[model samples]
Target: TNTPQPKRADRSKVYMADLESALHYSLRVEAARAAALSGAQLDAFKCYVATLVKYFPGRSCVQTYLQSLDTWLRNWTEPELPRSILKEAMKNNRDASHPAVLPTNVTWVGCQGSEPHFRGYPCGLWTVFHLLTVQAAQNGPDKELPLEVLNTMRCYVRHFFGCQECAQHFEAMADESMDRVASREEAVLWLWSHHNEVNARLAGGDTEDPNFPKLQWPPPDMCPQCHKEEWGVHAWDEQAVFTFLKAHFSPTNIYLDYTE
Candidate 1:
């Protein structure tokens, strides 16, 4: 038989030790960076770093650590550098060493000078939401919302709204709005406004009441077919739309499609 073997290491303990070691390594790296920079410049860097820490804490408090590095930078330099120089240095450092940290899902859109029908369509909301979905998806597979929710929303847009095109447009708009929204309240308000507008027209009245207005009796254009076909389609009437939007939009379906 062979000589006795040394004791085996505990797997959990090893994992914890590895994690602590990595954290220490990161701290050391940041400390080294800070050691090179100056004070006022460090403050500016801290502001940026803090923002990153607040919104996108992917794996750890990288932002705060970065801020500390900024502080170190402030105290390390001779006569201290200007804030601008610090900013430039930080930017260059990030570009070289942390290229993946930059924003990836932001975009701009304008309908002006575009086709008339599509020009005033207000597609910003859709674009934003689409970006939000992409960001959420990239964060992790588990973070992604259910596809069925999107499907349900699409179905609602198709049936009750009468125009698949508008529905599609709205879906994208909703997504965009969600992405750009600063808070949950804003998102709720946006959906509510859209719902109320549709309801007021459908109910045949002004903007005060939340429910859909009664169909304008005798119809504005006097085209009975048009009145029946186009007026008062609620965006979330379909089960799919209703369900998918319920989480993000609103739970209660209080408004009607017509004014009267």
Candidate 2:
């Protein structure tokens, strides 16, 4: 039996598709590199890979990256992988990227930082994963989906995120209230709020890309209704934040602007 091919897209549609593909390609590449670096630390993370192999949620974007990372080390997509494959990939080569399947030619648009040592991959990492939660929320009944996304993220960061301090901070943030998320909507809101808190803490820190200082997201210019009171001291209109998060993270809303 042959698999049926979908209808071909028109030129404009093809262009859009290419652009979106480019964006996702960059994200997958970033995840691949981050994971390889984190996963390959055998001595530092000896038991961590086993945990990921056992507990990371099966049908999510995170899983896709982890699984494909076994074979190609990037270039995304595959069904849920078993424990042995991941274990095999991590064998012997304590610091290899497996194969570097994601292309090196892509560029960041919304995630690009001003300086070489600044916001590039880390920024993309947060945005892409947040988009995953939003994507998960859109697919079906909230209860039907596993609540393991945050835990999965937790284990991954604990084992594999390149920056130790950042991972520790994320682990602490997860400790605060990640388990409280009960539904898809709450999951989206939880990540968004947590992200804002991080932004607030880093607003004037040296790690901040001077050109792209982190303000609590959705600044007044981006979403006026999302805020109330004053700049840097206002409370977010939670409903507005939810709406903004859904729309912003939705695949339909992301554009192909390959510029900083």
Candidate 3:
């Protein structure tokens, strides 16, 4: 008899399952400490807390989960318990909380790829930021609010993201031009443009999934008006791109498929 294959998530749409999986993985990695963290790691933990508190639509369960984790992290070292005691306390805190819920209104089609090594974490994470930026823009009359999302994302990636070189590169990019973003709308566009640039740079690199090659996203087929030929060079119509992104990342686009 042949062994059974695991059922794969739907590749055509972003499943809530994958996004929650990614978030859970991040929380475990960031919090799995057997000893007290160094100063830098502590700062990273602080950033993680800010990322949760900054506000986004939906996912009330996730907000509660992070809040509980933050409570434990803050109280940690008050009495400096033995390592075994501390570990048990952390375990109890996590167990008391509800299961991790997917972030609000985030989706990426490639999350389920032909090969297991392709798209998973990066895709899920980008969807989260994209959803967050869009939601921040929606909730904004405060021009500074949207940029808060961008900055929090930068800090989270700089400190918590496992890929050090990738984190440094993202930090450099944010440092280079993020200050120039002046309005809520501009913050949304800035992230989309930079995401495209990263896609362009990695298009044919070893990490590129041959089955789903990276492209300047929202290709012509997806949004014809977003692209154009200028002096025989490809370019995007900023207004169209902005419109597409706002609609694409909106809550209505989120799918509950494959979710618990």
Q: Pick the candidate with the highest lDDT.
A: 3
lDDT of 1 by residue, 91-122 (tens): 31333343322211222122121233331122
Candidate 3: tens digits of C-alpha lDDT, residues 4-70: 7645554334455555656665655444433654465555655556565554444566666566656
Clashing pairs in 2: none
- Candidate 3 residues lying further than 4 Å off, grouped into runs, are 1-13, 30-35, 38-40, 70-110
Q: Please count the clashing residue pairs in each candidate, in the order shown.
A: 39, 0, 0
TM-score of each: 0.22, 0.63, 0.78
| Order of models, best TM-score first | 3, 2, 1
lDDT of 3 at 172: 86
Give, for candidate 1, the lowest lDDT window spanning 10 residues: 251-260
Which prediction has more favorable TM-score, 1 or 3? 3
Clashing pairs in 3: none
TM-score of 2: 0.63
Candidate with top TM-score is 3
lDDT score of residue 94 within candidate 3: 32
Candidate 2, residue 125: lDDT:
56
Question: In angstroms, what RMSD does candidate 2 have relative to the true structure?
Answer: 10.8
Model 1: lDDT equals 0.34
Point out where model 2 deviates above 4 Å: 1-102, 230-233, 257-260
